[model samples]
Target: MQVTIDKNSGYCFGVEFAIQMAEDELAHGGMLYCLGDIVHNRMEVERLNQKGLRVIDREQLELLHDCKVLIRAHGEPPETYALALRNNLELIDASCPVVLKLQNRVKHAFDLSQRQDGQIVIYGQPGHAEVAGLAGQTGNRALIVMTEADLDQVDFARPVTLFSQTTKSTAGFYKMKALMEARIAAAGGTLDSFDANDSICRQVSNREPQLAIFAAQHDVVLFVSGRKSSNGKALFSVVNAVNPRSYFIENEGELQDEWFAGAATVGICGATSTPLWLMRQVAEGVESMGELV
Candidate 1:
């Protein structure tokens, strides 16, 4: 059996930066707490946990005082920073540059729209840390639309400035934008649609086309990613769409020998949040199964 691995299948720039920062902090030999999972992958988080990187939530933050807490790649709102300040907790902000830029843009757009009596509209999953951070910038004035159906919540007469989560599907974002435009048109109100920022990271957008091509080269494909990762879902969709023999797995333990049956050529790929080491393990496991056969 032959096996191939995707060149682009590994930690993205954002995840890479966050992990490196955490590792650097761990080297200093201090208790480092992360506001959330450094990334979506459980293995990576566990690995970091073993290295003195602690993952905590809002509730944990309230109890701890005078400790170092790192913000994950998904940036937090200003309120989180305020909390850190109040608690005297040293902060290591590892917000992805792309997400940081989006946060700034959200703030700017909200400020601009506020002057004109308009509301900022975000096309992303509500309650997501990124969306909540963006919405919090506007003092909770931002409205989240996860689907076209969510458009009904928007006031069609008000001008809407739209932004997207860094990992959302481009097609979905555009579809929601079109729906918002149509709704305003029907309402006969002055709808000024400001520039729609395609904040979907390049790491994800570029991977789909590459995965499609890579999948074509193999007889079977294995896609590994965390179920909660948005990029994982998006990239897996592309792999399965292009290669009917593709199998999705969350980790090496999920690999099944049946997938390798009668297959001579196999390929392994994963989302940006996936660790390269995990993919390597999956590939090795698949090869071990082939050897036994």
Candidate 2:
């Protein structure tokens, strides 16, 4: 049996930077309060928690004062900064540059939309951290849509500007765009009044094709990613589409021996938030199964 890990599977630059910042802060021998999970993976979060990282919710953040808080890669809304000021809290901002730029763009779009009576629409999970941050830029006026049903909230007759979450699948974004275009036409609105931006991160979009190729090359594919990771769900769909033998697991412990039955080659891959070490661990587990095969 052969076990291989995809070279393309691991943390994106933004996630890597945030984790590095957290580790650097933790190295100074103090408790670092993170606004949320530094990354979606529980194993990695637990590992960091052992190093004095404490994940806190928004309610908890409001109650704390005059302490250092680390902003995860997902970023935060303007109100979080306002609250920090009120509480005299020091924020170690580790927001991804991509997300920050998107927020700026959304804010600018929102201002323009207000003048034309337009709507700001986002293709993302409604309550996701990144979506919340993006919505904050528009003063929470942006319409969040995950499926055709969510599009019901959108006024197709009005001028609409659409932006996608950075971690969302490229196909999903384009699908939403198409749906919006169809709706606009049905409403007798010209496409000129519609603006759709494919704002997904290049690092993430590029991975789809790479992952498709990787998945096809393996006999059995094990996709390791945290269940809550948006990128994980998107990428796993791609892998599973290419290779029906694909299995999504958070860790090696979830691996089943039945999955390895008659599998000569096994491929291990993960989402952008996934750590390479976790993939390596999964690879070792596959190798152990190889002996039994």
Error of 2 at 270 (Å): 0.3
TM-score for all predictions?
0.95, 0.99
C-alpha lDDT values of all predictions:
0.85, 0.95
Per-residue CA lDDT of model 2 for 40-71, tens digit only, reads: 99999999999999999999999999899999
Model 1, range 150-172, lDDT digits (tens) per residue? 88888877777888888877667
In the order shown, the candidates' Cα RMSDs to the true structure are 1.7, 0.7
- CA error at residue 115 for candidate 1, angstroms: 1.5
Off by over 4 Å in 1: 291-293
Model 1 residue 64 CA deviation (Å) reads 1.3
**Maximum-lDDT candidate:** 2
Ten residues in sequence with the least summed lDDT for candidate 2? 284-293
Prediction-by-prediction clash tally: 0, 0
